[model samples]
Target: RVDFTKIVEEQKSLREDFNKLREDFNKMLLEISELKKGYGRLERRIESTFNAMISGLTDLSKYAGLTLEDFTRKILENYLKGMGVLPSDRSLRSETIDSEQIDIFCEDPAIVGEVTAYAESTKEAEKLLKKASVVRQKLGKEPKKYLLVMTTNKQVYKDIQKISEENEIELIVGRVV
Candidate 1:
């Protein structure tokens, strides 16, 4: 005789097993969705942090530049005073004339100069020469001296030095930063 009870019991067990597997798969999907959301949040946080760091760095760079300009101006003033080019009361300063900004400028005994934290190429020297030319054109008189001061320089210092000499731009370098 055929055993109908056994077949029915086996079908019930198979149905239960299928239900359990489906439940487990749904739980795994939920976990994967939560992980994806977490990953998105983490990405946003990292991007925000990176942007903040870049902004802070930019501000710091500007502050450092202004500080260096002040330091260069003081040194140039003292040196020129010692050399008898600048008067005791007069001071070197930054000026903008006809939209051209001069990093270092003096009225009496005309002088034009630029200050940089670091210079790696001769183009820097050439740029200062061009600025001097613009200042001369705007003022309708040639400056007595054109100066290029750098806190540090790379291997191209020799080429820059040559350009400075040929163009009569006094190059002054302090200890490397």
Candidate 2:
């Protein structure tokens, strides 16, 4: 009463089903791999586009004959003037003394500042502090105000802001460039 043929046929069917499942799993793995590759490509493309845009904007700024530092200096001067911290007639300008360059300096009101397109680290804040110290040492007096002016708010990190606050450095962001 044993049906060997039927048992063999059942075994063959099970093997076929197992093979089909394995093929399906392999296909799914390939699809997942392809999706990952596609995502990587898209991420790279977006980064490239962003860099290109920034480069274009920099070129345009150059053509306009105004560097980011110059633009930031004008904005800071206007702001200080409005606040009555700086005189209406006194304008900010760069000066180099004792081989140290001050990006924005005013003698009478004793304002010392540095300008940058973006501030992304505490190092920038520390650099301004060091410059301020040098100016104080050279001039034999502390400046009335220390400033760090940024043209773009795009990359002003929290650590930079905190350091500026703790060190009593006024961090001002004019506008996005």
Candidate 3:
């Protein structure tokens, strides 16, 4: 016979796990709050111009279950498909963590998705641009699918525009994080 108390204990364990998850989530929220303290400068500048460019929730609590990379890849894949740039069959590559790292690589077209994910700092943005350049160089003189750099930071968009025009790289940026 099944021990009914054992089932009750199992339920208690599940509740404890959920409670731990909530604590972790709240901790992440505090971290994000601290990071965003001085990031709103450009946000204020572009408030008028890209008012419509930014859509969706300013607070991302609904996505608490998702990691930054997961969130970025999903948003990117959907955004590319939405922009009619990438094929619907394309999926993000995640397993390989190589020196020449790429977030998502399209198999058929061989496009590389190098997302910056810089909500505050532009260091990640710069690194992605450099990596994308190196990847392009490694495949020199061959036609390649676009290497997209996606970021939520407003400041990076300016840099992206300048770089795209200079190097002829394609970039897709979502306005609101």
Model 3 TM-score relative to the real fold: 0.47
Q: 1-177 in candidate 2: lDDT tens per residue?
A: 269988999999999999999999999999999999999999768645644554455446677799866755665677679889999989989998678788989877777887666655566677788888877887787875454433435455556657777878876543334
List the candidate 1 regions with Cα displacement exceeding 4 Å: 1-66, 146-148, 151-154, 175-177
What does candidate 1's lDDT look like per residue over 5-112, in tens digits? 889888999999999999999999999999999999997686456435433443465667657576566666876899898999999999987677788998776788
lDDT of 3: 0.55
Worst 10 residues of 2 by lDDT: 145-154
Question: 1-177, model 3: which lDDT tens digit per residue?
Answer: 368889999999999999999999999999898778656766555543433332232125146676545665676567668767678877756423347676665544445655543435545446555655555565553223233333455565666656556655555544534
* Candidate 3 runs further than 4 Å off: 1-64, 95-98, 119-122, 137-157, 173-177
lDDT value, residue 80 of candidate 3: 68
Q: List the residue pairs that clash in candidate 2.
A: none
Clashes of 3: 0
Better model by lDDT: candidate 2 vs candidate 3: 2
Q: What CA root-mean-square deviation does each model show from the true structure?
A: 21.3, 14.6, 19.7
**Where in model 2 is the C-alpha error above 4 Å?**
1-63, 145-156, 174-177
